[model samples]
Target: MALSTSNRAAPSSYLSLGEVAAELGITDRTVRNYVARGVLPAHRIKGSRLIRVRRSDVDALLQPVPVTDGGDAA
Candidate 1:
């Protein structure tokens, strides 16, 4: 049996909790809270305290703000 490898690769990257926090402009503790609350997903390294989150997952967290008419008279 032989393993096969593909020449193509996806643009996926993993980020640490601190990195995720920095990207979101929030505290690392807050990032941990989000993970704990299931708002964000995280993966724990085997036999280590390190945790990793996919960059795409972090991007998914971002949402556009809705604009309101603010009662403007036309």
Candidate 2:
């Protein structure tokens, strides 16, 4: 799916945690953990378990994570 550039300034205006995960190519759990660890900010919807993640926050996570070439630990 193509990401809309029309609202680039406000990307997270309507994105959910799941959507963020898809955009970042990560698992939903990882997105949730971000929220848990305070890396990503989220807002709880009234009368619902749904959580919304800001687009800017997700964008920040796109930075490359340092890792070893192999699957071994650094």
Candidate 3:
């Protein structure tokens, strides 16, 4: 008998909960809250609590708000 393996690699978009939290300067609990509130998308691995989020999805949520002229600038 011999062990077998493939050269396939994991998706680049997915990141750990801690990675997302650290990038946002927040805590894991806060990240979990965002997931719970439906503000962010997450997926938990089957048979375990390991959560992963798409980098694109997280980046979308962190996009900077556009500034508009209110005609009141001093």
| Shift of residue 69 alpha carbon in model 3, Å | 9.4
Rate residue 47 of model 3 by lDDT.
53
Tell how far residue 25 is off in model 3, in angstroms.
Answer: 0.9
**Once model 1 is optimally superposed onto the true structure by TM-score, how far is the C-alpha of residue 23 displaced, in angstroms?**
0.5
Clashes of each: 0, 1, 0
lDDT (tens digit, per residue) of candidate 2 on 6-73: 32233337578789889989999988887787777776655565677667667777778897688767
For candidate 3, report its TM-score: 0.69
| lDDT values for all models | 0.74, 0.68, 0.75
Q: TM-scores for all candidates?
A: 0.68, 0.62, 0.69
| Candidate 1 clash pair list | none
CA RMSD, predictions in order: 9.3, 9.3, 9.6
Model 3 misplacement above 4 A: 1-10, 66-74
lDDT at 27 for candidate 2?
94
